[model samples]
Target: MEKEATRKKYNISVEATLEVIGGKWKCVILCHLTHGRKRTSDLKRLMPSITQKMLTQQLRELEEDGVVNRIVYNQVPPRVEYELSEYGLSLESILNALCNWGETHIIKKYGDKYAVLEDSILNQ
Candidate 1:
């Protein structure tokens, strides 16, 4: 398939991985989803820095890539929720490793004051 051929063109596994998750917000969104399913509003609240447009765009992309699931509820006011797909859940270890590396980098660059913040992010 064309998809298979495109994947083969990547020189390394990391390149392939990056293709799926490469963006300013994808990994951060994934990290938040790792906690549990979240409504659009909840995600926006959790990541106040992201604009609504960017969050919606990233979520749509993740859904298309089979890394996220979107659930809709019909009602007077529609409700939508997003969670990681099984394939997305498979990234848990990788996400944790990335988080750990970031924590280490922060500690190395700054100092211990930010270590507590890292712990909280890891716990979340």
Candidate 2:
């Protein structure tokens, strides 16, 4: 018989959710993946502020959490890409909600989201 994984206890339900997605870069990375599949270089180009090492670590962690799919292709060198898993798709609404709230907050504080938000894939 196969062993079932143990369930983790969380103080609040959101804590469980946060355990997987909470962090400086995970949400941002996941947000990027929401747009489409991206290679490591593509992700780096998309988020220039993140260091390559940190980006790699974040990708590994996301993959371990079963929210991101990493694909490797056999080629001259190697090719890799990442996209959200089916399970990860469940977070789309939440990501959109967070984005909408951020827009509102930026506008409230800065008088215009256009002035505060960066021009990125998400904006385009």
* TM-score per candidate: 0.85, 0.90
User: What overall lDDT goes with each candidate model?
Assistant: 0.87, 0.89
lDDT of 1 by residue, 1-124 (tens): 4776554675778987998888889999999999999999988877778999999999999999999999999986999999999999999999989888987887887776354563435455
Model 2, global lDDT: 0.89
- TM-score, predicted candidate 2 vs. hidden true structure: 0.90
Clashing pairs in 1: none
Clashing pairs in 2: none
Collision count for each candidate, in order: 0, 0
RMSD of 2: 2.1
TM-score of 1: 0.85
Residue-level lDDT tens digits of model 2 in 1-124: 5455766668889998898999888888988888999999989988899999999999998899899999999997899999999999999999989888988898889998777667785463
lDDT of 1: 0.87
Per-residue lDDT, model 2, residue 10, is 81
